[model samples]
Target chain A: MIRLEDIWRTFVMGDQSLHALQAVTETFAAGEHVAIIGPSGSGKSTLLNILGCLDKPTRGQYFFDGRAIESLDPDELAQLRLNEIGFIFQAFHLVPRLDATANIELPMTLAGVARKERSERARAALESVGLGDRAGHRPAELSGGQKQRVAIARAISMQPRLLLADEPTGNLDTHSGEQILDLLDGLNQEGITLAVVTHDPEVARRAQRVLEMRDGEIVRRISADEVSDANPIFDRGRVGKRP
Target chain B: MKPEDTFGYAVNALIQQPRRAGLSLLGVVIGVVAVIFLTALGEGARLYVTEQFQTLGTDVIVVIPGKTETTGMMPGFTGTPNDLTLDDAEALLRRIPEAILIAPISMGNDTVSYQNKSRQVVVLGSTPAFFELRGIPIARGSGLPEGDIDRGANVAVLGKETAEELFAEENPVGKSIRIGEWRIRVIGVNGPRGTHLGQNLDLVTIVPVATGMRMFNRTSLFRIMIELRPGSDIEAVKEKIEAVILDRHNEVDVTCMTPDAVIESLSAIVGTLTLVLVGIAAISLSVAGIGIMNVMLVAVSERRAEIGLLKAIGATHRQVLLVFLMESLLISTTGALVGLGIGFATIHVVTWMYPAMPAEAPIWAVFSVLALSVVAGVFFGVLPARRAMRLDPIIALSSKG
Candidate 1:
């Protein structure tokens, strides 16, 4: 489970402080599948980064499993990310120098896993993502969707309780993008909580819950029961019209 | 991560960048080879001088007339006011029982002629003790007979090479040779004594001291050579001889030198020369260190994405720093090992070229060079690794430049 209380993120350029995320609050229980949808600069990625423990909130607090993250040191935060949270970046941030299996094994290597066990678990992780045949391919050699799968395997190799995906299908074709979403949906049904940020409404259509962000704040929320009545894509079309 | 794992990673990265690693290695190898070969040259010169003096005799002392000043004023080939004589040498021989053999020397350059063959050679005049003190043995015929000091025999002894040149294959014993104008009969031919301190030992002729003084028209001996009894306290003998000479002459114009002093001074000079040469060689090692640092900094910049990925995977700032440092250690450690082999091979080549040069590097010098290379690697490794450690994961991950 995750909880955010008045979270804020500010960036200072020159003498000006830009509020990237402002006074955001939310909670998601275990096994809840959610999607954050908005146009560019809506603070959706910033909120997901805060949830993943990758970036600290500039104001207020975030709690994961009843533990406040703002009070933790850098080493403690790193431990939390290692064991409890997994992040899937829009860019599929797999190490270019490593093969698919080695890329998946990196998180466990940092966790002090034995070499033999790391290899075995890395192979299993690759198989789970339907990338077993591509274990020896580097990111440069892999297709975009294959690379994204390896990145996914790497993220979940440690069996984190929560997965935060930031525009996970942003760089893929429609077909592979569908495949990636199907894989993530299966992981969520298996009891791992998932949070996906996306501009594509089709990807948002399958979420159990949806949150719409604009101007550094969450402006709308649609639960599973009300999902069919609300069209988030139609809302984005209305916002672009001139008065 | 385990240390073995860290090392394995480091080795893998170095293998990926072979040209960069090899260029750094070249710097260290050149430095080490220079140090080994130059220092061995210095040691070889020291050993050569020590061996030459030892072969002469440890208890041998040579007393020359006139003081050798610390300034640029050396005792030249001119006669001194308080000249050393045969009587002064005899006085020291009589007083010190340790003085087992004393020979008075008179030397000059002359043209010795035989029928149609003539050559210019060094003519040395001394008693029979000269052969014992100078380590020369006669091959045939008798040496200078006893009691010849006062009688001044007109007998001549030819050096091996000199005898061969003037007589061809003929026997020179009992044969007469003309030295300037005086006719002397060859009494003996010295066996080959090779070369010492670059002077050919077998190109000289010898005669009795009294005859030499008459031939050169000089009364004072050029130098007095004394052979002390084996195991004699040379310092005590030197003091006693100086005291007797000072009493007879009443001046400190005389300089006495023992073989020990020569050897000690020679070693000191060689030691300093070796250090200076080794220091010059160390500059290359410093250059190598700087090269490693430059390459590592570029590596950090080029691999920023990889660094970001590792940090995301749970690597700490310290682990990132250690990885870069370990990479440098691998480079330098490999360089040092290869450099040592290069140095050793160079020494062998030098010894092979100059068989008698006696070049051998000290074990400590070899160990120190290896240690120096590793230290250079780690020392210069710090700056780049620190830069990598301080990098922000967010900025690094997003940076396309």
Candidate 2:
């Protein structure tokens, strides 16, 4: 569960105070699949960063599982992020030196998991993402699709409640993008809350709810039923598969 | 993290960049080896000289007539020289209960001749106690008797080598040798005493002090050597002897030196020389430290992204600092060990080459060099490690350079 009340985030650029996020208020219940859809400079990534505890709003009250994150120290925030938040970046951000398995096991290792347990858990995570056979391959050796899968496996390795994917499919081919979206949808179906930040309308259509933004403020909120009818692409998915 | 785990990581990291690590360690190795080898050579030389002095009777004290000054324009060596006559030796024997034996020595270099052999040799004039003080055992003939010294008899004691050179396996005792114009009878041959302080002890010939004074036309001055009573404090006896000499010579300038004082002075001079040598060697260590620093800085720059990644993965700032610091420490410590090995090897090689010259490495030198290497590592490594640790992770992870 996550809540933000009247969040305001500003950045000082030379003489001007630029508003990255302004007077935004939002909430998401557990197991909800949501998408924050906006064009470039729409503050979607900044909102995702705040949700993932990588950054904080200048003026806001943030509550995660009933704890006030706004008052937490940097260390405490970092610990919370380490334990409860998983991020899938557009660039994948896998350590180049580590293989897929090591990359996936990194967060658990940081959490001080025993080596044997970490290996077992990392193996299972890889297998779930259909990358068990490629565990020994480094990111440089992996394709764009395979690297994203590795990133997804790493994100869920800790089984964190919230998964934040920023443009998860932005760098992938169409087919790879579809496979990545399917993976996220499957994870969302397993009762894990998912929030995706994307500028792609097709990506935004995959979520149950979409919050469209302009400038630094949310312009509109569309329910899945309304968006599915409004966008023809969602109708094609409904025709081909059971929702 | 546990210390063992940290150490394991450090070792693994060092192993990963073997060339860099080896290069870094080479600096320390050279430093340590230089320290050990140089120090060992110095210590060995000191020991050899000290042993040479020790062979010359530990109980003996020599009083020379001279004034050693620290500055100029004052009393030079020409100051009223202490008149240490043969009577002073008699007075010390009669008054000082600590005096076991007294010998007055007068030495001169003169050409000596035998049948057809002629060579210049040092002629020593002293009492019979000179043989006991020098630890020379007569090989074939008897040493000077008390009667020989009292009567100023022309009896000579030929050194073993000198005898072999001059007499060529012929009987030296009962033969006569010419010193300048005086013909002295070879009454005895000294045992082989080897070289003491570069001087061949056995090569010198000894006769009576009175004979030497008569031959050289020198008077009222002689080097008085006194051996103290067994179990007696030499320093106390020396002070008492100095008082007696000063009273006899009316406190005129003179130099009196005990064996302990001589050894102490020698050790002080050796220690100063060692310090100067170590100071010079330290320049090499500084160059080595700078080499380590340069290598670490390059490593830090190259690993910037990895450092950022580690930090992002929850490695604390201190942990990042420690990783770099440990890398430097490993390099320096390895170098120091290599240097120490080289140093010991050098000493061993030197000893093997020159069996007569002692070459021993002191334990303290080894430890001190090791300690210095660690200090150099930490001192030179901290800057680069701090620079690496302070890098902004977000920016670092995003950096393309």
Q: Evaluated with DockQ, which candidate comes out highest?
A: 1
- Residue A10 in model 1: shift from native, Å? 2.1
Q: What is the C-alpha RMSD, rounded to one decimal, of candidate 1?
A: 4.2
Best by lDDT: 1
Per-residue lDDT tens digits for candidate 2, residues A97-188, read: 67898788877766667778888999999999998899899899999999999989988988889998878988899999999999999999
Count of backbone collisions within predicted model 1: 0
**For candidate 2, lDDT tens digit of each residue in B240-351?**
8778877887774556666777788789988998897689567777788888899889888877766765555455567778878887887888888888878888888888
DockQ of each: 0.31, 0.17
Report per-prediction Cα RMSD to one decimal: 4.2, 5.7
lDDT of 1 by residue, B1-401 (tens): 66776787778778778998889878777777887777777877887899888887888888878777633344544345477778887888899899889999899989988888999998999999988878788998877777848567788999999999999899999999999999999999999988864557699889998888889998778888888889999889888887898799996667778788889978889878977887786787888888889989988998887787677667777778888999988777788788788878988987888797788887878788878877988998999899988787766766652
Docking class of 1: acceptable
- Candidate 2: TM-score? 0.83
Q: Which 10-residue span in candidate 1 chain B carries the lowest summed lDDT?
A: B70-79
Candidate 2: where is the Cα deviation over 4 Å?
A28-37, A48-53, A70-78, A87-243, B49-59, B69-80, B110-123, B148-151, B167-171, B178-182, B211-222, B277-283
